[model samples]
Target chain A: MKLFFGEIYDDHAILNEEESHHFAKVLRGQEGDVVHVTDGKGKLAKVEINSISKKVVEGSIIELKTDFEKKNYYLHVAIAPTKTMERLEFFLEKATEIGIDEITFLQTFHSERKNIKIERIEKIIQAATKQSLKAYLPKVNDLTKFNDFIKQDFENFTKCIAHCEDDIVKTPLKSILENEPNKILILIGPEGDFSRDEILNAEKENYKGISLGQQRFRTETAALQAVFAIDWELKS
Target chain B: MKLFFGEIYDDHAILNEEESHHFAKVLRGQEGDVVHVTDGKGKLAKVEINSISKKVVEGSIIELKTDFEKKNYYLHVAIAPTKTMERLEFFLEKATEIGIDEITFLQTFHSERKNIKIERIEKIIQAATKQSLKAYLPKVNDLTKFNDFIKQDFENFTKCIAHCEDDIVKTPLKSILENEPNKILILIGPEGDFSRDEILNAEKENYKGISLGQQRFRTETAALQAVFAIDWELKS
Candidate 1:
C-alpha cells in the first residue's frame, strides 16, 4: 500500500508539500490513483486522487479510520541530546519505528541540542513513520531545560531517569514491568549523565533512577532501549 | 581508559593494522602510554606501550582479564541481508554493542549478500565493540545459503524464524523467554521475508516461528529487535 503523510478533513485530504511533490513528480501519480494517507494523529484515510498538480495533490477520501494500529500504551521519552545530531536523529528514527508517542530533547548540564534543526528532525521522524507504516507520528518537542522540564506533573506515568551514576540505587526497567504500567516516560541523560542535583531533583518528584542494562550504551542507544523496553514488554 | 581491538598473547599484545594506525597516528600514541586491548575473543589486556611504529604498536601486557563483562547468554542471528549495505552494517554495529555472539548472512532466495565486503563489516562491529567497552568481539560468518545454513546443528538453542507469513501460528519472542533460554538463534528474513519452503525447512528442524512485534519492521530493524529482545530479557 502506498502511504503518505497528509492533512485530513471532513471528506477530502491534501498531501503535504513533500508528499505532494513525491506523488506528482517522483511517483508520477495521477488522477484515479488510490493511496492511503495518514494524519499522524492515529487516523488513516484511503483516498482516490481527484486533483493532481505540481504543488498540491488533493484526493477524495474513500474511507476514513481512526485509531489505526493503536497500541495500548503511551511512551514519552525525554532524552539529553547527543554531541552529534546524527545519534539523536537515529534515536528519533528508531523510536518512531518501534512505537513511541512523544519525544523531548532534555537540555542537561552536559549536553544540549543547541544547533538542532527541528525541521530536519521532523523529516527524519516522518520518514521512519512512513517506512514503518505507522499512522500516529511521535511528537517531537523543542529543547527543554532539565530543571524546567522536570517540574511538569507526571502523576499518572511511570517517570524514570536513566543515569550512569553509580552511588544512586537504580532499578531495572523489567522490575517496573511487573505491574504492567501502560503510560511510561523515561528521561535518558547525556554521556556524562544527569548531574547529581539533577537526579536528586527528579527523585524528589517521584522519578525513579533506572538502569537499562550492564552494558554502557551510548546516549541514543539508552533512549532506544527504553522505547523497546515498553513496546516489547507490553505488546508481548 | 582507551580500549582497542587487537591480538592478545601470553605477555604482549599487538594492535590490528588499522587500530595500530589509529593509535600511532589518530590518537598519537607514544611509548609508555597505557591502553587496553581486546583480542575480540573474550580476553582484555591492560597494556603499556613499549614498542611503537607506524603500522605496529606493540605493548607489554601489564594485567589481563578474561571473560570481562561476559554476558550470560549467546545470540547467533542468521539474517537475510538487506538490499542496502548500510542497513546490514547498522545491524552489525548495534548487535555488537548489545552483545551478540555470532552473525551469519543468510543467502536467501529473496535477498543475498552478494556484494557484502566482510572486512568492512568486521570493522564496523569491531568499532562498536570498542565503543561499548566490550571484551568479546562478535564472530562474523561468511554468507551461507539458506538451505545449507539451516542444516547446521542448533540442538540446544531456542531457534526461531521471524517471517511475514501469517499462516503460521507465530509465537512472540517474549513468550519464549519464559524459561530464560541462555542461547538464542533467530533468523530474520529480508524485506520480502522468507520463502514458504525456507520457513518450513526450519520448522522441520524444530525452529519455531516467532514474531518480533506487531510493527512491519524493516529487515535491519527486525534483526536489531531480536538482538534487543534477548539482551533486554536476559539482562533484567
Candidate 2:
C-alpha cells in the first residue's frame, strides 16, 4: 500500500497536488485501491481510493490509527546555511531521518549565505520524510537573525551552542542527553564561525558552550553530528 | 597556513604546479608565510614560503610532525553513487569529516548512475581534509563491477554486508564495533539493493549479514552512520 501525507477530515479527503500526481500517474492507483495517508500531525488513516486524477485524488477513510506519542524529547538546531544549498539540504535530510523535531536558519555574523530558499528546503524535507516513513514533519522556521532567535523564550529545554574557539569552555554533548529532557536545542555556527558578540549573546541567553569533539567540521556536518550524538545519547 | 597533499618521495619537496597555483593565486601565499603539507600517508610537514607564483610556490620544510595513527580499525564502504552529483559530493565531504578510510562505488542491480567525475571528487576530498586538518586522505576507488570487487580476498578483517531484507542475520553493527579487529570492511547495497544471487555470493565469500539499525537509511547516510558508529564504539 502506498502512503501519502495530507489533511484528514470527516472520513473523506483529497491528497495534495504532489501526492495526487504521484498516486495517479506514478503509482497507478485506481478506485478501491488501498492506501495510507497521514495528516503529518500524528494521524494515520487507511483509505480506499474513490477518485484518481493527475489534478486530484480522493479517498474514503477505512480506518484511523493514532500513534502513541513517543517521548517528548525534541532536537532543534539553529545554524547558518552553507554556501552550497546541497550541503544544507543534506543536513536537513539526514537530521530528519535521525529524528529531529524542528530546525531553524540563523543569519550569523560569519555566515556565508544569508538567504535561504524555503520552498526548496521544504521539498527536501518532504522527500526525506517519505523515504524514512516518518509521519511527523519537522517544523522549519523561516530565516531569522541569530540574536533574535537567541532571545526567544525556549524555556524547559537544554540550550547549547557548538563552536571551535580556542577556549577551555568545553562539555561533551552526551552529558546533556543523559539527563532525559523533553526538549533540547543546539546551535551550530557557519564556516567562519560565530562572532565574539554572538557567543556573548548566546551565553547571556543561557546557551551553554559546547564542542562536537575535536575535529573541525563543516557547517552542515557539525549540525548533523550534533543531531546524531544527541539522538544516540537519548536512546542509550 | 596553506595545506597540500603529495606523493611519498615529494614529502619534503616544494609544492607542485596545481598545488602551487592554488597556494599562490587561490590562497594568496607570500614570502615568510607558513603552510602545512601532507604526504597523504600519515606525514605532515610545516613549511615556510620562499617564493610564490601561479606555476610554482617555493617553500622549505621547517618542521615535520607525525601524529599518532588512527585506531587500528579501518572502514571501506562500497555504495552506489546517488543520482545528483552534489549529493554524492555530500557523501564525500561528510564521510571524510567523520573519518572514513576508503570509499568505492559499485554498480548494483539498480544503480542509476555509472560515470563519476573523479577530479571533482578529489577536489571535494581535498577541501574536506584541509577543513578537518587531517593528515590522512581517504582513498577513493574508481567505480567497479560489484562482483569483480567482491571476489577479491579480504584477509584478517571482519567483512559484513548490510541489506534491507528481513532475515536471520545476527551480525549487529554495534557488536562488530565492540569486537572490531585491526581492519573492518562494510559493504552497503544500492537503492534497489542487492539481488538474491548477490547476497548468496557474498555469503559464500564469508561476508556476514549485518543490520545498521532499526531505521531504513539512504545509501550515503548509511555509509556515514556506519563510520560514526564504528568510530564511536572504538573511541568508547
Candidate 3:
C-alpha cells in the first residue's frame, strides 16, 4: 500500500505540494484509489482519493488510528551545524530514523556554520520519517545563540552536555541514561568545541557533564551517537 | 604542532602531497619548525624540517616512538551504497571518526548503486583518519557483487547480517558482540533492503541474523550504528 501525509480529522485532506506531485504524477493515483495518510503527528488515516488535480489531491478518510503514544521516553538533541551542510543534513536524517523528538541548532563560540536552512532540513526529516514508516515528524528549531538556547527549562528531564574538556564531571551517555527518564536532552558542541564560558554557563544552568565516548566525534556524529546510545540504554 | 602521516620504518620521510601543501603553504611552516608525524601504523615522530619545496617537504626525524598496535577486536562493516554517493561518503567519514578496521561496499539484489568511486571514498577515509588523529586507515574495498562478496571465508570470526524481514532470527548486536571476539563482520543492505532469497542465502552461509533496534534505519545509518555498537560492546 502507498502511504501519503496530510491533515486528518478535518473531513477533507489536502496534500502538500510535494506530496501532491508524488501521488498524482509519481504514483499516478486516481480518484477512488485507496491510500494511507499520516498527519506527521502520530495520526494514521486510511483514505480514498475523492479527486486528483494538478494543484491538489483531496481524499476522504475511511479509517483512522492515533499513535500519539510512543514507548515512554523523549529524546532531544541540540548541537552546532557542521562546517559542511551535508553532514548536518545527514545527522538530521539519521537522528529522525533513530527517533529523536526535537533538534535545536546552536551557534556556539566555536561554531563554524552560524546559519542553516530549516526548510531543506524539514524536507529531509519528512522523507526519513515516511521511509521509516513513522507517523510523527521530529521538530526542527531555528538556529539560536548558545547562551540563549541553553536557558530553556524542562520538566523532569535529565539534561547533559557532551564536551571534550578534561576536569569536567563525565560519564558515558549510556550510564547516565540507564534509568531512562521520561524526558532527556543532550548538548553536543562543534569541532572546536564549546568555549570555556559556554561550558561554565551551561554547568551553572544545571546541565550535567556527560561524555559520548573516548573517541573525538564530529559535531553531527556525536549528536547521532548520543541518540543511539540513549536508545540502546533504554531498550536494553 | 602540525601533524603528518608517514610509515613507521621510514627513516627518510617525504611528506605526502596533501600534507606537504598544508604544512608549507597553508600553515607557512618554515625549516627548523618542529612538527609531529604519525606513520599511521602506530608510530609518532617528532621531526624538524630540513628542506621545504613545492613538491615535497623533507623532515629529519629527531625522535620517533612506535606505539601503534591493533585493537583487541576488529570491526568490519560491509554495506550496499546508496544511489547518492554523498551518503556513502558520509558513512565513511563518521565510521572513520568512530574507528573501524575495514569497509566493503556490496551490490545487493535491491541495490540501486552498481559502482562507487573508490579513489574518492579513499580520500574521504584518509581525511577522516587524519582528522580523528588515528594511527590506522580503514581499508576500503571496491563495490562487489553480493553473492561473490559473501563467499569469502573467515576464521575465528563472528559474522552477522542486518536486514529488515519478518522471519529473521533478530538477535541484538550487543548480545552477538558480548564475547569480545577478535574479528567481527556485519553486513547492511541497501535502501529497499535485501530480497527474501538473499537473506536465506546468508542464513545458509552460517551468518547470524541480528536487529539493530525497533526503529527502521537507512542503509548508512545501520552501518555506522553497527560500528558504534560493536565498538561500545568491545570497549566497555
Candidate 4:
C-alpha cells in the first residue's frame, strides 16, 4: 500500500495539497482505495479513501498505529552546509533515511554556504521518511551560527565535534559512541573545516573532539558518516 | 602542491593528456615547479616539472613515497547499478573518497540497469581518488552476472551479502566484522533487491547474510552504507 502524509481531522484524515495531488493524479488513487497515512508525528493510520481531489484527499481511518519504529536514542547533527546545494540536500535525504532525529545547518567560521531553505529541507526529510517506510519525521532546524549555537545548552546530550585538524587529540567516533548516550549531538565542519577558535570554543563548552576516520571526507559525507556511525553504534 | 596522476619512467614521470592539460592550463604549472604525482599503484612522488605541453607534461622525480595510506583490510563491494546513472556515479565517487579496494557492477535478476559505461565510472573514480589525495586507485571491474560472480572463489576473504528479505536470518554487519577478516567482499543488491534464488545461491557459496540497518535504504544509499560500515568496522 502507498503511504500518504496527512493530518487527522476527527474520524478522517486529510492529505496536504502536494501529497493529495500525488495520490489523486500521480498514483491514480481513487475513492474507496486503502492507503497508509503518516501524520509525521508518530502516527500511522490505515485509511480508506472517501474522496480524491487535487486540493485534498479525504480518508476514513480504519486502523492506527502509534510510535511506530521508535528508537531508543536520539541523534542530532549540526553541520555546515556544503558549497553546493545538492550535496546538502543529498545529506538531508540520506540522513533522514538513515534515521536521524534532528539536523541543524551550522554557520561556522569556515562555512562556504551560510544560508539554507528550511522548508525545502523539511520536504526532503518527509519524502525520505515515507520512502524508507519510517514513522518518525526528523526535525530540520534553521541555520544557526556556530558562536550562538555553542552558547545554547544541551545539558542532557553527549556532545562531540568532528574535525580534521591534527593538533587536537581526537577520539574515534566508535570509541565515543561505545558509552551509548541516549542523546547525541555531533558537529561537522565545512570544506575549509572548522576554524581553530571554533573548535576551542566547542571544547570549552564540553564538546568532545572526535574523528570520523582517516580519509578526508567532504562536508556532506562527514555529516552522513556521523549519522551512520551513531546509528551503527546504537544498533551494535 | 597539487597532485597529478602519471606514469613513472626511469627517473622521470609523464602525465597523461588530461593531466597535462590540467597542469599547463588549469593550474598554470610551469617548468621547474614542484608538484606531487601518484601512479595510482600505492606510489606517491614529489617531482619537478621538467617540461609542460598539452600532450604530456614531463616531471623529474625529486622524492618518492610508497604505500602512503595503505589500509590493513581490503573492501570490494559488488552492487547493481542504480536506474538513475547519477546515483551510481555518486556512489562510486563517495566510495572512492571513503576508500575501497575494488568495485564490481553486478547484473542481478531485478537490476534496473544492465549495462554501464565503464570508462565514465573509471573517470569518476580517478577524479575522486585525486580529490581525496589518496595513493591508491580503486579498481572498477566489468559487470558480472550474479551466478558467475557467486561461482568465483573468494579464497580466505570474508564474503557477505546484504539483503532486505525479512524471512532470512541476517546478522548485523558490525557483529560479523567483529571477527576481523583481513579482506571483505560485500554484495549489495539492486533497487528491487535480489531475488530469493540469488540470495539462496549466495548463501550456498558461504556468503554470510548481513543487514546494514533497519531502514529500507535506496540502492545508492545502501551501497554507501555498506562501504561506510566496512570502513568503520575495520577502523574500529
Instruction: List the per-model TM-score of the A chain.
Output: 0.94, 0.92, 0.92, 0.93
Q: Which candidate is the best by lDDT?
A: 4
**Preferred candidate (DockQ higher): 3 or 4:** 4
**RMSD in Å for candidate 4, one decimal?**
1.8
lDDT of 4: 0.88
Give per-residue CA lDDT, model 4, range A27-93, as digits (tens): 8888999988988878888999998766989989999888988888999999899999998888888
> Which candidate has the highest DockQ of all?
4
Q: lDDT of candidate 1?
A: 0.88
lDDT for each candidate structure: 0.88, 0.79, 0.82, 0.88
TM-scores across all candidates?
A: 0.94, 0.88, 0.91, 0.95
Candidate 4: tens digits of C-alpha lDDT, residues B1-236: 68889997668989878999999998888899998899998999899998876788998999988898888889999999999998889888889988799999999999988899999999999988988888899999999999999999889989999998999999988788889888999999998899999999999999988898877789999989988887888863
Off by over 4 Å in 1: B53-56
Model 1 lDDT per residue over B1-236, tens place: 88988899999999999889999999988999999999888899999999988889999999999998888888899988899887787778878888799999889988845657888888888788888888998989988999998999987998999987988889988889877998889999987899999999999988999988887798988888888888887864
Q: Write the per-residue lDDT of candidate 2 for residues B37-102, one digit (tens) a residue.
A: 777767788887777766867777777777534645677888888877766787888888788788
User: Which portions of model 4 miss their true places by more than 4 Å?
Assistant: A9-11
Better of 2 and 3 by TM-score: 3
Which tens-of-lDDT digit does each residue in A33-80 have in candidate 1?
A: 999999999999999999998889999999999999899888899988
Per-residue lDDT for B132-206 in model 3, tens only?
777678888888888887888866779889988977677877778776777888889999988888888887888
TM-score ranking, best first? 4, 1, 3, 2
